[model samples]
Target: MISGALGAAIVATLAILYGRALFTPPSEIDGEPLVAGAARVLYVIDGDTLQIEQQQPTGVVRRRVRLIGIDTPELGRTDAPLKAATADQPFAREAAELLRQLTAEREVRLELDRRRRDRYGRSLAYLYVDKRLVQEELLRRGLAVVDAFPGDSASMAKRLEIAEQDARKHQRGQWQKQ
Candidate 1:
């Protein structure tokens, strides 16, 4: 049985993706109605951010989601002024592009931690595609660093730390010297 919070979240997501129709039978374009913890990727916002589509009772809803447990350098997001204060680092554009290549237009499963949203109101989640974790991929490739401020569990932080360390040692992506 699904928990109440999770059930509500699922309904909310469906409403967001599908619109007021709410589970109006899966159409040809959309494979099926998504239950809780799943959504379709609309686009990649940055290395750690994504825009996802969910079905709603009224219509499809699109939302911005931020990846938990990792922090990649910036590409000057207009909506995030504080982020723009920092200088763009190595591989910033490449990191975002890689994330786009990996997740754009794909369906993903989201795993939430104890906390769901960030102070900035972006949904925090661990996204998976084709059984692979996107956060882990970024870390292993050195496109992102382990920064667990948004994560509730320490295990994710520890795992990301190890992965980032490995990427650094191997001179992966952003870890390489210019």
Candidate 2:
């Protein structure tokens, strides 16, 4: 009985440790800054997020970044016809492509939100390309909808609300008639 209990505890401990390592962000990477200028867009994860490649002293580091205050419909989400039509491709791919068109290879500034990285270890940042808020631009273009997770509790909800309202009013993207 004692051996069984000890073995169970050891297994549980290993599982937890592995999970933490998988989910937690790295303490430091070559190009990551607590706060820094926006680098070039390497790729977009979704309409509301992207991966940026920045040059650091050591080398280039690709950082996954989520746009503040926006969420777009999943590629195959129930309500989005376009997304559903392209079921073979992941939902985020379209958004990423659009983002690439908008900001790939362009220099932009980056601002940190309340949190630096999300549970998935992606950076949470507000991007500004040529003085434009990348998040707001995505909203204006109807590429993404507003989304605020629990980690963004400190953010100003009003911005996301307004973005959603505008997208609805304009019938942008999935909001438009199929």
List, residue by residue over 28-147, the lDDT tens digit for candidate 1: 234333234668987887889987877756566566788988888887545665554555677888889878888877788888787777788777788888888899999999899887
lDDT of each: 0.78, 0.68
- For model 2, the run of ten residues with the poorest summed lDDT: 25-34
How much does candidate 2 score in TM-score?
0.63
| Candidate 1 ranges with C-alpha deviation above 4 Å | 1-36, 56-59, 77-87
| Overall local distance difference test of candidate 2 | 0.68
* Tens-digit per-residue lDDT, 1-178, candidate 2: 4698899999999999888767644433332563577488766656766777766675566677877667765544355666544452333555656777778778978877677776677777888889877777667666677777666644455666677678779887556666
Best by TM-score: 1
